[model samples]
Target chain A: MRAATASVAAEVEDLRRRYGAREALAGVSFRVARGEIFGLLGPNGSGKTTLFKILATLLPATGGRVRLLGLDPAREARAIRRRLGVVFQHPGLDPKLTVLENLRHHGHLFGMRGRALAGRALALLGGLGLDDRAHERVETLSGGLARRVELAKALLPRPELLVLDEPSTGLDPGARRGFVAHLDRLRREDGVTVLLTTHLLEEAERCDRVGILDQGRLVALDTPGALKERVGGDVVVVHARDPEALRAGMRNKLGREPALVDGLLRLEHPRAPELVREVMEAFEDEVIAVSFGKPTIEDVFIRLTGRRLREGGPA
Target chain B: MMGLVLPVTTLWWREVVRFGRQRSRVVGAVAQPLVFWLLLGGGLSASFRPPGAPPGTGYLEYFYPGIIALVLLFTAIFATIATVEDRRTGFLQGVLVAPVGPWGIVLGQALGGTTLAVLQGGLFLLLAPALGLAVSPASVAAVLGVMVLVAFGLTGLGLAIAWRMDSTQGFHAIMNLILFPMWLLSGAFFPASGLPAWLEWAMRVNPMTYGVAALRHTLYLEVPVAAGAVPPLGPSLAVMGAFAVLAYLAAVRAAGRKAS
Candidate 1:
């Protein structure tokens, strides 16, 4: 079991890509183990898309090295593509073709044919719960259903590695969950390795490992539980009038400064409940509400980069 | 090799299937050229007599082969517009990552466009007898052969242009600014013999002019015309064949380069 899990499915060492004066990926590095579901999490303009394009072989890296299935992407891209399946952030299905037609065409591109191709496509549709609508045009299907067809098409060649760019972009919560579950099933049943990029924290949480990117740099890389523990304690958010005054008063009294964010005093402590109670009682006039909970992936991001996971509004 | 042939056939099949689904494209491809033939041919028949002609040929008969060439040009340009659409909708992204090279993708599109152009041009040939032109088996076969050559070259040119354009509007503007004028000056609307020296020289040098001249030569193979009237068949075919190969190479080169 140890030997089986130690094999690397994909690797990137100090990979970099630049567009004119702007650096999209700056010396990023990571390795995905066989059958692992690795996720790259970052908000818009964070270079995750640029990195995804390079891995897909649609774009070339300006510096460093990348290996897919132990094959160099710059030199052996065709060989790597033979063993890799890709799903883009936008829909790749031909809207005019039926779901089965789309899958069959993809199989043909991989040199698949006749009974074997048809059976593989139908079986994948059945697995994805889309067999009943196989004959329907892709344009007639819902976004979630079309996404399932795209997944079925990619799996037709039985690829060793599957790369998806922002796989859950437009999917609803339920659909996203269903999509992730399908990836899990592929990993368990076929031993296919998955590398997906997304800005959704919940989506990253479901992966075996997550790489958090911020402005072309990876800020953190670890299992969700391990990364969350970096905060070391519960997160406490204190809502009050004149948050700066309350923050100053708390610093003078408690000898620890709480971060002022969006008109709230936030802090991390081992004894969050006791601290919340003390703050409520001492500054009862200034305090509006005090809430505390175990640190989440969002808190982990906030701790590493003094900014929220999303800006302007919630993800 | 399976690596090259399979993707080309599949991509080609996709273009044909998509063209079938969009009924408007079918009607527009056939109808637009038919309208041009009728309006222009009818208005000019009385005053126009192609230079060095057999004396009694009307403009309707004179412009018949030119209209067929126009049909091919239209079909090829419209068919290759899918490249821009495929890029815009992210469909081409999927194909680009496949094991196939850019040659496979461009060839598939060029062949798909050729098939559509030949199919439509053949249908237009049915109207030849109406203009007192003979419809013989030899002429029909030869005309289709010429149609395939001309269509393939035109489609490759279209793909070469379409692959570099980010928007369909830009493609339209380029086609208008470049291709439409080339078609008008390709000896399609007027005989090259009677034009001003410079304009006639332009017609002689235009690759599309050779394609139109070849179609005219093939359409009248059964009933021969004057020597040096339409361009010689051997040189016309050679020019068209070279254009097809060059244009296809250009398209593959465009697709091979990274967009960044």
Candidate 2:
């Protein structure tokens, strides 16, 4: 038995990337433990992909040190890549090649050929439930199937560290679920350390530990429950007939005030239901409805950084 | 060693499989040179003759060797654009993140592009007889050897340029600016016999000039010794070898920077 490698799977320290006037990654530092599902959560332009690219040895940092399994990414990139598997956000499969051929080609890159290559490729396809579509051209597959193919390609070498950058972007709901489930299996069965980046809060919650990246800084890093708990106070959202007036009434009654932005009154209070009932009783005619719940990752994000995860999108 | 071979071979095979799927690219690769041979060679044949030309020889024969050089040039240059596309599409990232070193990517691409160039160059030989040019078995083999060297040299140069270019638009613009000057200055389309002293000097220094001269020497069964032409197959091959080494180094460096 090859003794289980105890070294860190990935480590980035004081990493910074500058694109002319803009800083893509600014002093970003993080470490992913061996065999952990680490999630890099951030919205667009928050430097999630940039950080992942640096860890994958695909991009250089302006000033930082990156080590993958004790190998320097800059000087020992090839050796690091041998033990690392990366699934890019975009579909990187060759469009002309079939799914199985894509995996075979990827396997060949790692030095596997002939029956060994073919057997592993087929087994991966079967494991991914893509056996029937093995012969189909990658261009002919749907977005979700193509993403699955990308995953299968990444797993062909059985790499110790699997890096996925927004692996579920174009995937439908079912496909996303299946993909996550498959990744979970990879973590559980194969003991592969997964480093993934995503903008989806729910997906980030599924990770063993989530790192919240906002504007090139890791604002929060912990398990989902711990992060939500840190925010404190259950989230009390008041949907009133006149949000401004109700917000004023609640502010006047509670004397503690709440965050009022874009017609939603959000308050973090220990007795959120009591506060909601007190506000509703005080403004019986003005209040329309009250919804109370424990703070979710989204609320945590909103509280930490005065914006929702999908702020501009359809709520 | 197996680690190196495995990734390089994989990337090379992927490129070949991709080339096989694009029918139009194949046609463009083989057809463009033949068209240049027929149209430009025929048009020049009527009015233009070799300075100390032999009687009864058509313009196609004189232009045939140049067309082979052109074929190699076009294939190699277009392959550079494919590299740019691969980079833009993130496929290059996947390749870079593989176990193979940066040099492996450069070598694999150069080898794959050179193979395609050779395949296209071979088709030109089959079309030679139809153009009233005779190709003996020896000449065919020698021409193929020159084609390999020229293709490898040009592929290295293309990979170097593609690695330097940040965007496809920038790559295409640079290609347009360099392609015509390099082609015309190399004397691929015309003889350098009557060119200005400076222009002839440029041709003498141009790598493509050596490639064209060597290829023409084998294809036309004539000693390549123009006024400013670098004589002997040895010197020309040396220039190409130098280019291959320099371009390969640049490619490896650029790939390393990008991968870093």
Candidate 3:
């Protein structure tokens, strides 16, 4: 049973959730393999939170099944809860409590106790670089340190499947790198399956596999490598004063069909380093700036959807 | 039983821990009621003659038990109404996902409030001697028991409301509209028997009325019953106990519901 459960950390089947007249999660489904970091990638209002809540067993779906650690969230929430560690998107620490006190109470809530519980809490805090700050109140900590404490609390239980919501929200670049690397270490050492939701493509890039959501539906699901490869070679983007004319001229004159997104001409070419000048010269006066490079997860989102992955966020 | 007791003890200890850290809240909750009792009781004692008063009983003496109930109410509100803050700050979200069930959570919260109310009420109990009120070991025990029930019922009511509230400002509005009215008409400030018919009925139905009546009865246990005694001791104790149990069950049920 352990081996069988080890292969699939979480499985979802056509999960649907409705909030009054609006459908939040409309027939979403995916499976996360054991020890893999799976990311649910979408911008705000794309049902990412709705999906996260359903998986957390905080909300019941209007339809379909959600199983985490081989247990149904609806039927076996308590059993799943014992094995599932969740870090919410918002700050969940008690501002008045010290870091160790917060973890002690959290452990008690999960039926943990005594010297062993203390041992585990200290171990987690030590691993997260919060050992020295153990006696400090959570409200006094910086955003990055507080986030690390939250992770320590979530990791204290040694959950088989760990779920986080926008785990990189308040962390600086270096802290974000360390956080993911810590999660990667958890996967390697403990075979813990990790899932996180993010609106930023860069954050999604850290996941082993990503499920792209749009308008309450799963648009795509694949490895980051596979998702980018779908765009093929390099993507050349041309910012032009007359984007429509530039796009038309690229297709009509150069026999090149480039997708127009956010008023920019986007062409996925096998040899974009050489094709950059061709597209720029083709619309010499019309083009303001031309760039070509390895296709990012953003380019894949544009190739798949006709819109940018995020409105505004750091790359 | 450790499953239930451990969570309850830890949560109750958490409330005490949090209370110790917040000095302003302690002063507000403990001292605010003392000021209210002194000013209100002093001003009203003159020419305030309700039926069933021992011929020479002053309003301050009469309102003494009522003020203890008020202190319990304040402490109950102080301790448990922060559930809205915890919810707003997202800490409650973390608790909800834990392995503990809703019933355990509710019990922990309700008991936490009860402990603080009992403690604060106990502090006021010490002042009873200065007020010329008698205190035997028996009366002290009796008051603590009744205060526990009264505090538990009040805190559970707060829990039922707080678990659903997303903001503390909204909670304060509701507290003023609902909780204050309940305390005011519970025969805390006045006598129930001497009231007009409809007002009498409202007082009789208010659960805190039974709590205050029980406290008064226990404090005045050695004394003879006056003509205008409220609800008698037996019925008051029964009603208050039932209220505590019923309110707790309601809070647990409310917490189990899916919050948006």
Candidate 4:
């Protein structure tokens, strides 16, 4: 038998990508341990796709070293791909093909055939609660069902590592929860290492660890809880329609400068309920809107980089 | 060995399934070539004739094999749009991320396109008898062999072009500029003779010219062993075989490029 290798699912060192003159990924380094669900959290243009492509062996990095499942992606690409299951951000399923047909083709490409392949496919469909829709065309299925099929196809070969790019892009809230629960069960039972890229805070929150990438560089890397903890305790965003007087008055009186992003003041404090009251009393006429809660990955983004996460469509 | 074979078979089967699902592709692939052959052949038969033609061979009869070659080229080229569609629809990304080698990917797609071209071209050849030509079984067999070679070459050329293109519009530009002119210069529309010196040289050197010549030579097997106007059997097959090899290599090289 081949001896077991290192437990690292993925290892990247000083990864960089350049398109013409713009650097897409600049010196990003991180490691995902075996059997861990790691999320590469970033907004649009944060180089998540570039890094994902490199790790998946679909695109080469301009400068850096990457290893997937303990094998160099450049030299041992075939070996890495053999053990890697990838779910792309775009729809990879052939819409004209039936769910079972797509899975069959995917299995055959991975050298899975005969009765064994059929049995495994059937099991995956049953496990994913799609046994009845096996013969249905992928185009006819709902977004959630199609996503389930994509997941089924990825797990068909029992891959050691599963890489998903924005797995919850088109999913509804209920479907997204089910998808997360399915991944959780997979981790609990099969111990499959997963690496996913997403811009959603809730999705990143479920990850065992996350690496926050901002503007082609890794800004922070840690557990979502620990990263949130870096923002003190509670998070508050106070929107104000004011001239320069509001900020200057608050700076002189409170002595705590709040981050003004997009004409809004964002600050973190342990006693956010009391702070919200005090800020309201101090600037009642100047305030436009206000909201407060515990810091999420979005707040961590702001706390670390004085910029909002820019809640927008999928990256 | 099974690893390579399995992926190739799966990809090839996918082409067949996709082609079958799209009924319009079948109708369009068969209909467009027939219309072109009839319109061009009928209009030119009144006046156009080669310098030294085979007796009883009018423009329609002369342009018969060229029609088959056109069917192969057009259908083969159009079928390769699946690559661009695969990229747009995100199917090719999955295949690219698979463990399969570049050779397997190229061979699977090439053979899939070749099979569709030959089958589509074979359907067009049934009209040979209706066009007043007696196509014997031997001649049909010979034409089938030539179709396989040209189909493989044309499909490889199409794959090389389509793999690099990110959009169907860019692919359309290439088809018009490169593919159509290639067919036009392949002695398909007119014979290589009775042309200017430079034009004649272009026809002689064109690889598809040999493809057209090969098909024409095979279709005349029922005729006298010695044929006129058409190039010799030896050089045409040699050129086609070389073209198939070189085009396939070029396609594999394109597919294997790291940063595209």
lDDT of 3 by residue, A1-315 (tens): 678766999988998999899998889989999999999998788899989988888998898888888887878898888898999999999999999999999999888899999999999989888889999999899999999999999988889889999999988899999999999999999999999998766678889999998889999999999999999799888889988887788778999888887777888889987798776566688989888889988887777778887764432
Better of 2 and 4 by TM-score: 4
TM match of model 3 to true structure: 0.96
TM-score of chain B of each: 0.96, 0.92, 0.95, 0.95
- Per-residue alpha-carbon lDDT of candidate 2 for residues A1-315, written as tens digits (9 for 90 to 100): 123335578878888888888998888887888889999988888988888888888887788777788788778887888889999998788889888888887887788789988988888989998889999999899998899889988988889999999989988888888999999999999999999999887688889999999998898989999999986678888777888777677767768577775577888888787877777778888766778888788888888887877666633
Give the poorly placed runs of model 3, Cα more than 4 Å off: A1-6, A312-315, B226-228
Candidate 4 per-residue C-alpha lDDT over B97-160 given as tens digits, one digit per residue, 9 for 90 to 100: 7888778898999999989999988998899889787888998999999999999999999988
Q: What is the C-alpha local distance difference test score of candidate 1?
A: 0.88
Superior candidate under lDDT, 1 versus 2: 1
Instruction: Compose the digit string of candidate 1's lDDT tens values, residues B17-136.
Output: 999999999999999999999999999998987877788888888888889899999998897687889988988888887788788889988999999999999999999888878768
Model-by-model lDDT, in order?
0.88, 0.82, 0.86, 0.86
Can you write out model 3's per-residue Cα lDDT over B42-85, one digit (the tens) per residue? 99988787577668777888888889999988887775568878
TM-score of chain A of 1: 0.95
Question: TM-score of the candidate numbered 4?
Answer: 0.96
Supply candidate 4's per-residue lDDT for A288: 85
lDDT of 4 at B38: 90
Alpha carbon lDDT at B152, candidate 2: 88
lDDT of 1 at A103: 91
